[model samples]
Target: MHRLYVEEITETDGLIRLSGQNAHYLTNVLRQREGDNVLLFDSSGQVFDATITDAGAKEVVLKLTLQYRPKEEQSVAIVLCQGLIKGTKMDYVVEKATECGVSEIIPFYSTRCQFTETRKLARWNKIAIEASRQSQRVTVPVIKAPVSFSDLLSMIKNQTDSRSYIFYEKGGTSLKSQVLPDDIKTIYTIVGSEGGFSPQEISEAEATGVTALYLGSRVLRSETASLASVLLLQFMFGDMVYS
Candidate 1:
């Protein structure tokens, strides 16, 4: 079923009035008509089966017929703390991570970060939503604004229950050998930029209880490392649900 993320919806009200871009997309782009059934996902992670009750020139109305509530433990939260690299690498990470079911993406600035601008959250969020829609995910991943390395460590230090790993290009424990924390469902992965994190940055993250892990012998580019970390963690914990 075709799915859309709708903002205004209620359990009591069965009809969803879609206007603006939504109406235009469904009517003109998707060529949806009245009686066409589509799936709707709300911000609260609620899934609803809806039919196009009206696909008028002014608006598109959907009548929700069924609601599916996800299991309380159905999700395994995976947070990606990525160093901002130059070019479109960060954009690729956000889009691919969202497609792979990353719960949140934290774009941070390390000493070697090449991209220092922090004004791309809106664009990244748009990519995340589009990726979620393409992946048939009910919830879109949250893209957080960029923060300094210290600030990133503060956040990571607070996540005592999360399985935290920072991928180091140099010597570090192999990811395949480390045992994932069994008590927690939250996994946090950190990847450095093009030049990678400095020795001090790695030590700071390590002080916050982040395990320095290696992705094998081959060194990966910044974008590839970020995507690979998310894929590996999600594959071990959450991606199977989406698959």
Candidate 2:
């Protein structure tokens, strides 16, 4: 069954309304109609099996069947503090990071970042929505607007019950050597832009308690490095639930 994320839903209420682009997708693109079955997920991490009760021009209503699955979240939550990159690279990072079970994604401006504030943030949010649906995630990760390096450092340092890591080529320690704290439910990993993080910025992050970790001898692109680091963290601290 096709899955979608909805903001408005109630258990045992027997009704769900999907409007906006999702309704359009089902109506025109997927060609789905009344009586078709699909899955709906809410931010609460609940998946409901629902049947299409009505498909109209303005909205699509689904009849709540029952809870399809229980709440299933990754053991180790990951928030990717990704540096702003050019073009669609940020889109790719959001999509893949969703698939990799990142709990949240924060795009920030670094010393070497190439994007400006005028760029469309809605497009990035849409990519995250689609990716979450495609990856069967029960909840879409929270994405924040771009922030400055110093502000990001402050936020990371203030995070409660979570560790922070920065994936850099010059990182002295391998990622595998580090372990998630027993009480920590989440971890934040920061990745630099095409030009990587400046030494001063790295020092600031380190001063804020973000550990630097190395991938390997060969350097990877921004997107590749971000995705790989998240995957490795999940593998070590959390099971490969998507598999």
> Considering every candidate listed, which one attains the maximal TM-score?
2
Candidate 2 lDDT over 5-112, as tens digits, reads 776566446787888887998888888899998888877777888888999997988898878665678777888988888887888999999988888898898878
| Per-residue alpha-carbon lDDT of candidate 1 for residues 1-243, written as tens digits (9 for 90 to 100) | 787877646644668788898889888988899999998886668888999989998799888898888434235688988888776777888888888778889888877886576777898987888888898777877788888889988987787667788999886887778676567768889888889888888888888888999777898998999888887776667645443
Total clashing pairs in model 1: 0
Q: What is the C-alpha lDDT of each candidate?
A: 0.82, 0.84
The regions of model 1 sitting more than 4 angstroms off are 71-75, 239-243
The TM-scores of all predictions, comma-separated, are 0.91, 0.92
Clashing pairs in 1: none
Ten contiguous residues minimizing lDDT sum, candidate 1: 67-76
Cα misplacement distance, residue 222 of candidate 2 (Å): 0.8
Give the number of the best model, judged by lDDT: 2
